[model samples]
Target: MGGSTSASPCSSYQPSPSTVPFQRPPSRFKDINKNHVRLDLNSMVSTLVSDLGSVDINLKKQRSGLLKKHRDSQYRLVELQLVVRFPCFTMTGTPPSLFTMPPRRRANSVRCGKATQVSGETHRVTEKNGNDSLDICRVLNGMWQTSGGWDRIDRDDAVEAMLRYADAGLSTFDMADHYGPAEDLYGIFINRVRQERPPEYLEKVRGLTKWVPPPVKMTSSFVRDSVNVSRKRMDVASLDMLQFHWWDYANTGYLDALKHLTDLKEGKIKTVALTNFDTERLQIILENEIPVVSNQVQHSIVDMRSQQKMAELCQLTGVKLITYGTVMGGLLSEKFLDTNLNIPFAGPPLNTPSLQKYKRMVDAWGGWSLFQALLQTLKGIATKHGVSIATRCR
Candidate 1:
């Protein structure tokens, strides 16, 4: 909320809109092991428990009814997967669900290999024809992770990192109209790409952003203005993709917003995407025949809730799932590795209200004890594959 927007500071907080590649002197010193980049997770957890030892884990309060059912199914699927493979746990008194084996992270075994040049709307992700040809990097650039205080990002360094990622063939972008100046930053990068690269090369960069309006009455002018604001800030004449989000469904002004947005797309504003729309509501949108290409949602090992139903639904609707929170705010990585439940974490204070909200989620889904088991399980998997636990989530 601590943004330049005239609204609540945290509510509208914007970071430096996309900066062309950031320029920073490369550190000459030995690089810290990527696996252990943050402060000690174990110590932080201990301090945290000492401070809020009596605090209850906030799990069930914030999510929609649709999310719970979806998440339950995913958890059950995982349980079934584990039971089939590790009958030992099932034979023991403990059920597979209670076994608490952390999900493994094998960095070398990601399904997506290095992508090559884009030929058309679809690019060949692999040499094989039928592996997976998702052209828009299913995982777009995430600015939300930068919003929370889980890590300290050097702005200049971060910009340079973006350049590196783009060079590596991960060009599709994932951002929100409200994610500070992420859209603006993407715009700046695109302009630079247009100048430095050939026209064909420049087309590889596609940005997908969201428009999250308060649940309220929507008019054509209001919707157009919202898109215009993003266009002006991002300095783009046409948005490559526009995603939409709303806080309350009961209000139902979202329909009006979507109708107008689809009009923008028809007008060649770019593709339309959705962020965090539950499957039921998503179905409603599709039932009405609203066109959308992707739905951005929180999907990670701990939150495989998306897999419960979204994956199947996506297959049915031909929509792709662009996921975030797969890393659990870095809590899923080595930062929390070997961390005991008693310590509190120390990182930059969170600016996005969602961080605080999600911390409550960490409380639920099995508190520190359950989380500890998950982490231990992940550690085992990480060790098996020779990669950090973080890479597994990625």
Candidate 2:
């Protein structure tokens, strides 16, 4: 960000869409691997359409059950429209000038096609440490897909995809300890950046990971060892940010863990944050002076629970809100607008885990009829601006 380049990183490279399918080894075809099922992205989508019953069953066993448990209230009763719009980024790529949070509350304006630069605005989520600070990208590339259950991931292909995203001016990545191979993939991707890309490019790239340990003893040694494991997997000297998640809030081990995380920030950690932490617990965390920079939560048009109680606390404490589920797992897109899910082959199937989960959110927010009306409104707005509903939602 300090140095100016004649050519923006995105200006030089336009990543071509990868049409090459992952090739499995011939040895895998042997009797030893006869039961091995290899499903690509397309096949996964098709499977979701064909086998809704099985998908429903698997959705019950989602890995992020604790997060779901906390966010279940989002669907209780549908609230009126949200008056203000908060900052969000697309999963695809965001412009260089667009950082996390803009100082001013800008209107929900839309621009078609290419990214429009918001000149003279410093939109970043700052994690202050005395004089030093870490400026994170407004939209983070969530790597939960790398966790598993989606499809088979080729390591080289996945790393290439990461590089393309970084080259497109999207460098911030979010992952977690429980998300299998996410940290490992970030490690590989960052190394590739260091070796292949410009030095400044690596500077812009940030990897923020999470630590979701069970309700266990939060000993100094245990915490240190756990953080060290992530560091090693990420191949970084010090972690950019280590977000903490606690399953059973009744167990006061969360406070101990955050305290240990705060202590580690002096050396092994740069910033300590929280994931899916509600308002009351966050207030307690602040009262204890845990020094949390931000709280990552589910804040979307459909789910405005974060804006109700949490916004006041965050505003007062100067803690930023990093939101996920901004697009409702692609339900906000034109693919589902005006389509009927009641008919067997009418609308696009809720195939992916995100779609399946967020569909439930839609159901809780209101029935399909209400959601269709909301989608219709969004489509109208997007049409007026000459952009897709997905872009408008983002």
Q: Residue 393 error for model 2, in Å?
A: 8.9
Question: TM-scores, in order shown?
Answer: 0.64, 0.73
Q: Could you tell me how far off, in angstroms, the CA of residue 270 lies in candidate 2 after the best superposition? A: 0.4
CA shift of 133, model 1, Å: 12
Off by over 4 Å in 1: 1-134, 145-158, 344-358
RMSD of each: 14.0, 13.6
Task: Write the residue-wise lDDT of candidate 2 on 18-110 in tens digits.
Answer: 111222112111121111111111100001010001111222222122122122232111222323233322222221112133344543343
Candidate 2 overall Cα lDDT vs. reference? 0.60
lDDT of 1 by residue, 287-342 (tens): 77777776665544444444445555665656655555555555766666555545
User: Could you tell me the lDDT of residue 44 within candidate 1?
Assistant: 12
